[model samples]
Target: MRYPSKSALLFIAAGALSTGASAHMGTDLHSHGSFMTGLLHPLGGLDHLLAMLAVGVWSAVSARRAGPALLWGPLAFANMLVLGALLGLRGMGGAVVEPMVAASVLALGLLVLTRQGMNAAASMVLVGGFAVFHGLAHGAELAATGDAVAPVAGMFVTTIALHLSGVALGWSLRAANVWATRATGAAVATSGLALLMQLA
Candidate 1:
């Protein structure tokens, strides 16, 4: 009997991971009660984690041909994440935040999968648009607590670190195997789709 191809195995892994895409925790900031909680928030959820990493991967992959300028995608995401969180603290951008967050995961995954490219402005708008929802989710939850500065700061720093990690992974994958990068994208996209389904 023949073993599954790498792509098949990758997709299987993606399916396994997506099976539990609850998207976000429903707990309040007071429950966790620390900046570290906010810092760890993104990593706590599959939806946020994949989308954040996808931004870095897409940025680095695009930058391979577009020059270092394409790295701005991740920066755009990080900046907008803070903006979104602040807006969320104000109780804005709440109604559709979850759907939008899941959509970001799907969209960013496709970008990496297809190796899509766009001008700097368009890229920033796209990534930043999605980041707002991620931030909004965080902000909305934390809004009830009345202490957002420290948590948001933690999230901001963590977001940058996650993006940098993704960029490194993207570059390494690009050098070793383009198929692997696309496969990773495919996995991310699958997770996003699963997230959307769960939200629905």
Candidate 2:
């Protein structure tokens, strides 16, 4: 039996997803710190979404030979995000916080762009570090709330969804154009660079 083309599948996947988050730094979304906010957090921001997508896709691409990164990679990220939120709640993240956040996106995008074969364990560690900054961003926002349970729950759910979507995209793109995916990585990396420049 013949299967549908990979590009066609990707097109369908892309069209199925949408988000309404903004990318403006210093934007405070701590209106109530509800679960819905946390769940929608990652889904709202373009940069954060790109980073998560890159992580999932990169993990998938690298894991093709070994197995599937559909679980461990995101687990590492989710765990580290909890730790990062703790740091933010404790007021531990210093001035370098925002830069690190941008760096996380840039680094993840580069990973996807390179498509260098990395063991799943190593990839988890790298993406775990990136997840910390991402968590810090969210935690810093909810620092005043003092309750991470609902928000974290929301965030974890949204993040996992994004990761899954990325996994699908990576798998589909594999049968499509590797260069096109790489081009996506390049664009994401460039956005991170532009953000960093703005920060500086």
Runs in model 2 deviating more than 4 A are: 1-29
Instruction: Please report the candidate that would top TM-score against the real structure.
Output: 1
* Ten-residue stretch with the least lDDT total in model 1: 1-10
Clashes per prediction? Answer: 0, 2
TM-score per candidate, chains pooled: 0.86, 0.83
**CA lDDT of every candidate:** 0.78, 0.70
Cα RMSDs of all predictions?
Answer: 3.7, 4.5
In candidate 1, which residue ranges exceed 4 Å CA deviation?
1-16, 25-33, 65-67
Which tens-of-lDDT digit does each residue in 35-122 have in candidate 2?
Answer: 8878777765566777777777777665655364456887788788878876776777877877887777778768777876666688
